[model samples]
Target: MKLAWLRSLESAHQDCVWACTWVPATDRSGGLLLTGSLDETVKLWNPEDLSVVRTNTGHCLGVVSVAAHPSGRIAASASMDSFIRVFDVESNNTIATLEAPPSEVWQMQFDPRGTTLAVAGGSSASVKLWDTAEWKLVSTLSIPRPEGAKPSDKGSSKKFVLSVAWSPSGRQLACGSMDGSISVFDVQRAKFLHHLEGHTMPVRSLAYSPLDPRVLVSGSDDECIHMYDAEGKTLFSSMSGHSSWVLSVDVSPDGAAIASGSSDRTVRLWDPKMRAAVQTMTNHTDQVWGVKFEAVGGGARGSLLASVSDDKSISLYNYS
Candidate 1:
């Protein structure tokens, strides 16, 4: 693996940077980077120089998730307020607002076809699907309460959905919950499939390999990252080394490596087959919350990685 330090932005966020994503390249703009933070703002950056393009405000609580539509024209952000804001990516204008009661919002993703948006519902113990065309909620795919559990039991909070992912084909959805369980759903039928179990701590982040719909990666409060065969229902491997909570995990666009950020103030690069952390970047002064690989684009050959930390900074790295 090849790596290089690019640049670091101090005070990129007032609090923690909780999420990051690469917006696909468009004719009018080079690929952009989108990030959300506990500061209650979503920011857009020009990836080449790590310059701020826009700062979107309105989220009542921490902004937890930012997802770009496949068209590169729109994006959505979900916050602790349990609201989803759909907006024009280029203009930063609000297109729609989706709200669900009591259930908090964590992670979100747009389907490959951009026909729908899936959001992980926190305490609500469900994933909310919205129609892209009308910007209206279409369904709530809930995780069933555990067997023999009392209705008044706070186990529902444990089932809080934290991260959501869409398979490459957009036919399936997988969401990681606070209880350390991952639920798979058939998107077309809006039916719950099966749960993938292994992690005993909260699964904070998740990603599906771009090349394989069956491959899923997850990071957890257990300080380990897990690789799973979603369709096969198998736990392929677990990589442990982070000294604190593994705040986020993302697969490289090339599908060859996985990157993770941790509360241990380190960013790690892992080789799946070896099931080990190949590199640990210790440039952040506080807990690192988000890590993501840049999508390919203009003047961008090797992959670019962005990390946000509790120190209120964002760092960019070159991964070739």
Candidate 2:
């Protein structure tokens, strides 16, 4: 398994490209690349040619996260000011605008079944779930504070949530916090389960294996990637190689590998069985904020990987 350079688009966005995700193919269209940037625009690109399909604006204070629904017809983007714009992919028409005051939004994701949108609620120490049909706030999955720790304790507020991931089953959700701990929750029950602990810095990314429901991968500011058993609440492996903060992470379609982007300006592929980094691509000149695998892959293309950076560029690679 290795990554072959395919193509790169320099200055893909005017400012930092903070997030990227592959929109799955639908009956009416092929898969497309969705990206959010610090320039306050969310753009869709033709993955085949890296051409702009559409440039979506209306966000303020920089767009930081973008998520595609399982249906491929809808996408939601969140900006630094905590505003979420949910819109149709083809028409670019606004579907809904969501906001939760007193709780800033960081990362957002749609569940595999397309029923709800889960958002990382920054500073609120919770993950908010929204019903897709009604476009209404449904639940807030809050992290349980340590016993005897008062709400007045300064350290308690640092549990600001930064990232979240839904398991393959969608029955469970995992959220990463600035205080360096991962909290897993039972979605149906809206209950906090346990914390996966190891990294001592903020965890900026989280991914669940598509094949194994129990496996969860995380990247943190501590410059390490850790894989955990979400069900068992145990750290399975910790791989360290990046020289700076690991900003983003994703598991491949086959679940055989994990890919990560870092402040070190590199993207790395890790083998879970060996607990080691198998390959590293130093293709970006600045911090790499996002690395995503094409959700579904086959044919001659095999699997496609995309890395977006603070350099305002996007790089594509063929994973085989």
Candidate 3:
């Protein structure tokens, strides 16, 4: 696997860009890029030329996560203040503003079928699933505190969830926490399945292989990327290379490689089979917060990867 630098947008936002995702192709336009930043805004970009399409404003605090609906008609952005705003992709109109009182929101994603939205409930120690059609809270998958742990203990406090993901089949949901534990859940039964443990620091990001429902990859503040069997509850491998924390990670569309962004200010592409980084790109001078691969393929762009950094820039890459 190789990554060729396509283009870089300097000062893409006034502040750090923390989250990014791809809006799939629609009848009106091809696939476009969506990004959220510390400047309290979400921006849309044209992938072909790496040009700005539009800027969305009104978020109070730094936007922590952004997720696009599968149909490319709607998108959601969540900020540190715990508000989730869902808007129309084309008209940029407000569709819904969602919030769960006392439960801060972090990374969020729409299910594959776009029926439910899964959000990481930061202090609530749970994953909140909201129904899209009605925009109402459907259920909460709470992560039980460990045995012999008190409700006011540090162990419960460290369960601050930071990221969340869904399997390819949409039957399983996995969430990563500040305590370095990953909890997998059965979506159908709304039951907490088990926990996958290895890292001792915060797990900032997670992504499941598009081709395999059982395979899961995570990036942590421990400066390592771990591969896990979601069903078997085994950490099969851990790869480390970055000098600092691994902030973000994504699997390639074909499931051949993994791309990671680190606080050390570098983007590394790893060959999962070889269990090593094949290439490293060090163009950003500040911590890289997000790395994302386009979900679908076709149109003018084939396979694309995008990265955002605290240096206030956005970089696009060609992955093959």
Candidates in order have lDDT scores of 0.87, 0.92, 0.92
The per-residue C-alpha lDDT of model 3 at residue 101 equals: 59
Q: What is the lDDT of residue 121 in candidate 3?
A: 92
TM-score for each prediction? 0.94, 0.97, 0.96
202-257, model 3: which lDDT tens digit per residue?
99999999999899999999999999999999999899999999999999998999
Q: 1-320, model 1: which lDDT tens digit per residue?
A: 75577999999888888788888878998788898998999999997788999999979889878899998999988887878889998889999988867447778889999999988877888898899999988999988754444787656578888888899999999999887888889989989888888898899998999988899999999988999999998999999999999999988877889999998999999999888989989999998888989866444557899998888888999987
Better of 1 and 2 by TM-score: 2
Colliding residue pairs in candidate 1? none
Show model 3 residue runs off by greater than 4 Å: 146-155, 296-302
RMSD of each: 2.0, 1.5, 1.7
- In model 1, where is the ten-residue run with the lowest total lDDT? 145-154
- Candidate No. with top TM-score: 2
Candidate 2's error at 43, in angstroms?
0.5
lDDT comparison, 1 vs 2, better candidate? 2
Query: Model 1 segments beyond 4 Å from truth?
Result: 145-155, 297-300
